[model samples]
Target: MSISLLMAVYNPIEYDGRVKRSANALAEICNIKVICPAQDFSSDCFNPDAFDVMRVLSPKIKIQALKQIFFWVNFIFQAIKLRPSIIYAHDYYLIFPAWLAAFMTNAYLVYDAHELIIPNQGERISKRDNFFYFLESRFIKSADLVIAANQERANIMGEHYELKKIPLVVRNIPPMPKQTLSDKLVFRLYEKLEHEYQEDIHIIYMGDINLDRGIGDLINSLKYLPMRYKCILIGGGPSESLIKLSHSQDIIGKRLRLLGPVPHNHIPDLLRQGDIGFLSYSMVGRNNIYCAPNKIYEYAQSGLPIISTSQEPIVSILRKYKIGELLPIKDKNTPLKIAEYIKKISFSNEYKHAIRKFLLDNPHKSEMDKLKDAINGVIN
Candidate 1:
């Protein structure tokens, strides 16, 4: 019989890089179908290539707990009918239903633990997250395969849940770029920014924009840096807060360009134009302390030297690869330190050879093979 894989996630599939990458990789070995929440009513019938999508438009329930139950119930019913050879749960929230569906259908179950806690506001476990954590602890044991987004996460999950084995590590790095910054692509925004900031050293950040992400400190650092230094944020999150942070520095539109979120395919082109990659995850939660941010690889692949906080895997990567500098976390003078470091490495070409060598040594295709191997191992 032909193999079939059913993947479940609670977010809009388009915005979820891990789900997109994993589904595409797994598609090679099994017919893939994804069940995710629709972005809105407009995306209810949305479809993408390689795999079929089943987007559930959440019901209009005022109570948060009841609404979640409604979504889980829908996922279970839809997943059971498909009788997939493998049932993959992408988030902790879907573990209960995805586990139940796998039990009902006798399908091999895969739990892709994408986050330590739902929302992960801080170090403390909220009441809501406690329930989900309990579910994962209970149901994850039954999964035929468990996948962690990063190595540190896998280690933590194994210890946290006391699993028989650690989940497979799959770094969420983007595929090798088909086009580079020098390539003749018709991207008008990139062209315009390159022209406008030709003399400036661009510090590029492409991820969620929020206070917890240290966007405020990054923007404030502009005050210490010279006028030739610029910041470009390319992801979506509270624009008003970002705007407020930019106002005092008087660099919102000029030195700081909040480009918002762009298509995943467009990142390589946009990133290649930058001189440095900026990552500043606040060390408040377990997730932040043990983050395996893909921006390191993304920046390295694009040949941009990184400047980030001293988070675990990031610190280790920077130390090992010598691709960038690490700032002290939670220091009040972080912005000034970022500026100092930026000035220090403004013209250094030392990282160019290292970045080039690293990308050649480690490519996203290798990770894809690992994911495929994990799935195939379970199937066989």
Candidate 2:
């Protein structure tokens, strides 16, 4: 039976590891239809053929309320036109529309909760969110199946509702490619960086560089590092101001590279040259504490030693593998401590080999299999 997948996300085409992987995996089992919002209505990134396997389109709308209304109307109209056997909503924004559409069409509704919607991190739960949470509770009771990105999220749902809902844990882990870049391309990229600072130990940071992401601490920590190590801040967010702070400190001229944002495909090759990887988001909320970010797996896949804050799942994994350093978030000399830690890890062959082996052995295969089975069972 064919299944329609509805997602409410910002940019679906850019190589967001989780979204792309999930979309591709779903397409393997069913006729997938992804509906998302478009920043620019004319952008061709939403072209269905670009993904090669699914039908993707932007339900063009400007405001949030209007978007929600249009989405349900369009989804119901499309359900009648396409005749999908089941409907799946990826996150909260798509939930109401999918729920209404499924009810009208008598189709099974699958809700994929990538994060905790009500008590989310970084944003306060306002009256609007509380009201939505009440509706979300009802929707969960009504959904055919519920999928969460991690165990912590599943537990959150269990705390609030008591339905016969089976929560499937579908982690946002990326598949690591076995092949490395060609020597020629690596050399070319290395040469570009070499032109700037030949002696600097390059450290790489990717993903949203927001305030909660600990970019400020990371920049401040740079002062504690030895003169030979330089930091590269990739991706965009509030870190742009931190980049400026680095400049005022005279570190930006030679010791810092702020490449605002790059394409996701370019990240692997970019990571290859870096001596270390960093994922240092602040653990201020339940979502932050429980996050098993894609970057953690990405760093492992890239064979780079990671430096992260001692958050729950990340600290647990880092300590378990002994491949990365989990430092206290509020240490006064955090930058120096991190620098020293990096220096130690950079020279350790044993740690490097062990991490690479662990990544290869795990490879997120079991997680993907479980998710595939759960989705298949629900849709069937």
Candidate 3:
């Protein structure tokens, strides 16, 4: 007998790697159904037969806050109608509504928190964050189960909520299927560069480009780097302006290649073209240190060494795995230090292949199984 599980997610079906993996895993034991935003509904990962996706019209630019309001109103009603065995909420905003739906239908409630939403030391916590924290705490206190993306965040949630048990840590990692780089893709990225950059070391930073994500720092630091060291930023965000600024500059202009946002499915192939992956989030708060971003896995999967700031968990992972070096964050000299570090390292094709194998082998399906079991354990 198959049980019914309802997943309420805010993102489109095409992306959301974490949700896609979780849904596929849950489908093994449940009749999986998804309620997601109608925009960008095309998906490459999901099997249409195994799951049914209900599309809801998401609010556009106007009255953006009302979007959540509209979604919850629709979600709670749908949850009640579906009467699923479980209501899995992907965002904190949906937690309260999912809890209410679970209460109304006697279904298990699961909250999947991807980050440390609460502010850490030295960071400003606005009234809006406070209000959401109140709702998040309420859900943590009342929900049948809560899952954080990392162990540190799980501990933080437990301490802050004063809960008897810590939330389970289910990190947002991609599946390890040993993907092969396409022959055509081997030179497409290099073809974008001018003849001068044919010999440059192609450093890439592929993800959300924003202030907190250290895009400004990454671009500005390139000025100190050698002319032969080039950077390709392969993502878009509110910080597109920063990229424009870098593009307009005379000194670092030619070296910086800003590309449009690549879809999640094509990211791995794109990442394979880079010499190194850059990850440098400004550490204004513990969230930056405690959180684990998907790029770490993506970089390793691409067999690219990383030039990253010493963020916790990420730092530990890098050091343990020996995949890359942490860029020393000394002010005024950080760029020079990064340049120096990159210049010193060398990797051969043999070593690159080994790194890719290590990445694929390191914590594969077993970790995902543990995550799947954590959710199913709630029913037991």
Candidate 4:
């Protein structure tokens, strides 16, 4: 049977590992066509031969609110034209429009809740979040299937929406590496580290470099750490604050090197060179508290022991796997605590063993299987 799956996301599908992974996995059982905002769409983002791509062009609306309104409407109209067997909404922003398109097309609607729309921890929900929540609560039950990144978020959504079933958990793990870090790559990395940074203990933070992800804390922690301890922040975001913080701490380039964003393909190799993986998301918002970040899986996959904030799903993973240390992100002392923990855990063999065990048990293939099974059950 030939099945055509249509996926719609407000963000570019290429940079989103969850959507890309889902698209790639669904291709195993069906034809795939992805719909994304045309403003920043790149053909190089995905292999055109594997699946189809459609970019939604928005009218030039000067007002930001009006622009977004046009974008989603265009997105919905585009999805309807394809007449896919499954209409997969990647985020809450697209949930209602996707529902509408699916209803018009008579397609099986799948709502993938990447994060909790409601603020769980009493953080003020913005007008935009409020709107998305409205869309989600209204049409969520109409979905034939719902997916979440982790079980905790799935339970929250199911209870919040009063759904008959909890959303399926599809983790955002990368595909298993075909090869470990090449000796040449390691040698080149070490040569630079040893020569420039005088190489002691490397703390690596990959993904969005922003205050929300605790980049500020990480930067502050560097001052408390010895000169031998250095941090390499990968990825790109608002860097003015981060740059100023690093400079004020007197660690910019000297101890903390912001390499900006690298291509996703280079992450595994680059991350493998690090001594410790840093995963810190501020616990101010419900989404942050319940976040099942892909960086944890990426860090473990690269064989680095982690030092992370104490948050749900993350705390559970670390505690269960015994792969890393978790600290509460609550006061000024937090950075000092992170620095001390890094010193204690650096080059430890125990965490390495735990990471190996974790990798052996969990792979992206299994997560892909879970996603495939869930969708197949609905479509078949």
Show pairs that collide, candidate 1: none
Name the candidate, 1 or 4, with the larger lDDT value: 1
Which should have the higher lDDT, number 1 or number 2? 1
Summarize candidate 4's per-residue lDDT along 348-374 as a digit string, tens digits: 689988988898888889999998899
The lDDT values for all models are 0.82, 0.70, 0.75, 0.81
Top-lDDT candidate index:
1
Instruction: Please give each candidate's TM-score.
Output: 0.91, 0.86, 0.88, 0.91
RMSD (CA, Å), each prediction: 2.9, 3.4, 3.1, 2.7
Q: Candidate 4 — worst ten consecutive residues by lDDT sum?
A: 189-198
- Candidate 1: segments with Cα more than 4 A from true spot: 41-47, 118-123, 180-192
Model 4 residue 204 lDDT score: 92
**Clash-forming residue pairs, model 4:** none
Which residue pairs clash within candidate 2?
Answer: 221-335
Error of 2 at 85 (Å): 1.2
- lDDT string for model 2 (256-321, tens) is 777776656667777777778988776666667777688878787878888888877787677778
* lDDT computed for candidate 3: 0.75
Better of 2 and 4 by lDDT: 4
> Which residue runs of candidate 3 sit more than 4 Å off their true CA positions?
40-49, 59-61, 121-123, 177-181, 185-198, 239-253, 347-361
Q: What's the residue-level lDDT of 75 in candidate 3?
A: 88
* Candidate 1 steric clashes: 0
